[model samples]
Target: MAVSRRKFISGSGLVAASVAAFPHIARPADAAATRSGQKPSKIIHLVADGMSLATLSMADQLAHLSRKRGLAWLNLHRRAGAHHGLMDMRSLSSLVTDSSAASSSWGSGSRIVNGTVNILPDGRELTTLYELFGQAGWKRGLVTTTEITHATPAGFATKGLKREAAESIATQYLDRGVEVLLGGGRKFFDKTKRKDKRDVYTEYRVKDYALLNESADLAAAPLDKRWLGTFAASHLPFTVDHTHDTKLAKSIPTLAAMTQRALEKLARHERFILQVEGGRVDHGCHMNDAAAAFFDQIAFDEALEVCLEFQRQHADTLLVITTDHSTGNPGLNGTGLRYGLSPLLFSNLLEVKASFSEILKKLSPPEERDKKPEPVTDPAKIAAIIKEAIGYEITPRRAKLLVPFIKKEGEPIYNLMNTLTCQLGQLMANYTGVGWTSGAHTSDYVPISAIGPGAERFAGFIQNTDVFRHYTNLAGIDFRNPESPLVGAVSPDSGILSPHWMA
Candidate 1:
């Protein structure tokens, strides 16, 4: 049945009213028991990197469809005394912030250029939050699905002129004495993969850091020693692909496992701060892969549940959940008559067995001596692969449209967003009803949800730089990093053409 616009609006109002009327908040006695006005002994900052409002909503819907529950993030909003708000995540170089600068704004309390971390445009080095907290005798930890040296995690602990200098960032982490480091980027630490042939693993071991290489290692790791765990050569595989591969599932740990271990290690210290990032969410959004993004978001939600449970037991811990910025602006678009088919189409996401990246690997041209293969351009072969990967059978005509682009022939359609991944994502949308605005970060104000002591400071519209000040205040540290003047700085559009995936 086709629902009128008036009826839809009225129905939405009723749902909103129902939500408001429910006693989602804790009782007055429960509120009194919380350590709201006390200083937090530890702070756990959880970031769903590149997540948008639409992405969060879709993840909630997916959870309801698959698990018969809402996202822990939203559930925290309904039940916990969480302070929900929006944050303006602009960088010094652009209104649409990249991960490095967005993280630096919080890390250094001063906005830097898009591609730099904790370094001003004029070559002045800004002290990072981890450094300051470390100076105040607080232990620091960084756990992410991306490389441990990636921008989001690096921003809190390192100073670098280039965010791409992963090796340098890894070295900085060791020098700065971050007690716990867990993620991918095995290449950055292995002497065989380093350009300079530096054996960083030896250096970390010399410092008494436990170097872990597999999921089983995390369980046996000693709580007394520091940790440096790298399970993949690069960013961890998407959750969808990881779960489907038995070997990968056993070898690599989930984000929740990493978070659990990091928290356990950090909690052993007198005071500590840990940043848990679902970094692959940004990569999935960059590739415009719906299943990859949503599944990773669910994985992030699971990690958040771990943190939430920790916060419940440790009232002196302050937990903050947020995203650096929105990317791809993904949403579920209406399909069929009066949007009747939208829900059914969105449900198809559950059937996706592999990521677009995984599917693209199957389309690679056959090995030959300077000769292109025909299978890449075969519509029948392409459609069959799509059906096997995502459980959706594309029409031959639709598969034909992907030929030229998949072959990298030319920009036939989607000029600016011309890429096989983006094109495939668009094609998949025809069957799934999920669409993306573009495969890049947006200037939208992302949401921030926090609980525990000091969360109230984040309860309204605030600048990204405010995060640093609040953390300092909570930790009883009074200091400010110097900011560069805007005069003679590069234009916001200077590096606008840089790779969107770099974030």
Candidate 2:
């Protein structure tokens, strides 16, 4: 099942040098363990996308502050048989990895460019984990809070030359042999919206895949057929907003519910690989929305609880939880008033009724330039709206700071929203001690934790690509073998399958 591409890695000078200097953290001993002929029946790889140590800690703190308990992931270390480690999530092209390259590292066992998924800079296409597992008789599936064709999930299933070519990626999954695919991006598959105007939902239905558009459909889908669920036109609603809105709560399934359904469907197979992603954690971080990010983290942890329950019943299952990279670099800074941070500061997140984006969409001035701008909304009303959306009280001074942007006739709505969100974030930081470095991913190391057989191989410091090495070895799949024959795999250089392999 090894990728047969000519593996010339595409990365920046720093990444190349680092690769040359410190090659292997530790070659997984699971290769020898595989020779013992005991492979897990299933491998559940769950990613809380764009989570850092600080993000993890904040999620734990938020959960504790609201409920009287710690998250399942937070308490994983206390379990008798568990392995935890930090993973270097750098990409081939940059120290700070994007979702595409971060996932490419794990999907292909090779570093790729920052924005490419499994496609090398030299234009080589590597075989993905989904193809490998599928060819080797394991059912493959994916679930995410992001689009199904998003880089993180798509990295495992298909070879996309560009991450934004989501329509093509959606088409790729139509016959990729994936048994279960669920997430957002209904636009990518809708015929009218697709650039090519192909009805992808119909294509999937023709292939006998059960198409699900709502929470009830996902819950009621039979396990006998493959499942395809797209719950949103874009990325799924942020957990915080969804939790508070009754209509969205009814229409969109929780990450845990999707994970549960995926597990139930895939459990019927003798062997399976299902990757569940808390993908919106990254989006929330990118937008600097703490309430959204923290709630999504908790939701992902709830998904982990489902995985842990499955593992308890099925001993031959490996459950690995990690993040692609850290986003925003959010951490708790010391508050001058308190000797130590207080959980009460984070409890305000519970009162947030909507996402900052939602609030902005509803309250911002219209984008049309031709129409004469209407009178600006009153400052007091604006302040009340912000407080209702984020639980951040806008003092008169803070209201003064936002007045110009709100009243400006020609300013883009997003600019005003960004300012408001940032101001609110700062206010939260003052009280809660939570602060963020930037709106982008950072070079900080991401954490990895695993339980069940071969979990020991994941312990200690490891490169992100080591995840591919370890998983394949644990599954007895020789990802290093260059001579293996692959079906439906296109050559990186030629962009065509070999004639002999086709036969």
Specify the highest-lDDT model's number: 1
lDDT of model 2 at position 280: 91
Q: State which candidate has the highest TM-score.
A: 1
Q: Which pairs of residues collide in model 2?
A: 11-92, 125-492
Count the clashes in each prediction: 0, 2
lDDT of 2 by residue, 1-503 (tens): 01100110010122223223322223342222232235577899999998888888888887766554678886889886788999998776567778887887888888776666687656668888888888889998899999899989988877846777799889888768689999999999899988889888899999999999999999799889999899999999988778677788789988888887788788777788899999999877776688788878988887887777677656678889999988877877665467454555655666666776676664565667678445336667777877777767777665666555445432333442344455545555765567776666788888899887778888999998888888888788987512112123234564321111000
> Candidate 2: where are CA atoms >4 Å away?
1-37, 365-378, 403-420, 481-503
Candidate 1, superposed: residue stretches over 4 Å from native: 1-36, 365-375, 485-497
- Each model's TM-score? 0.91, 0.83
The residue-level lDDT of candidate 1 at 358 comes to: 86
Candidate 2 global TM-score: 0.83
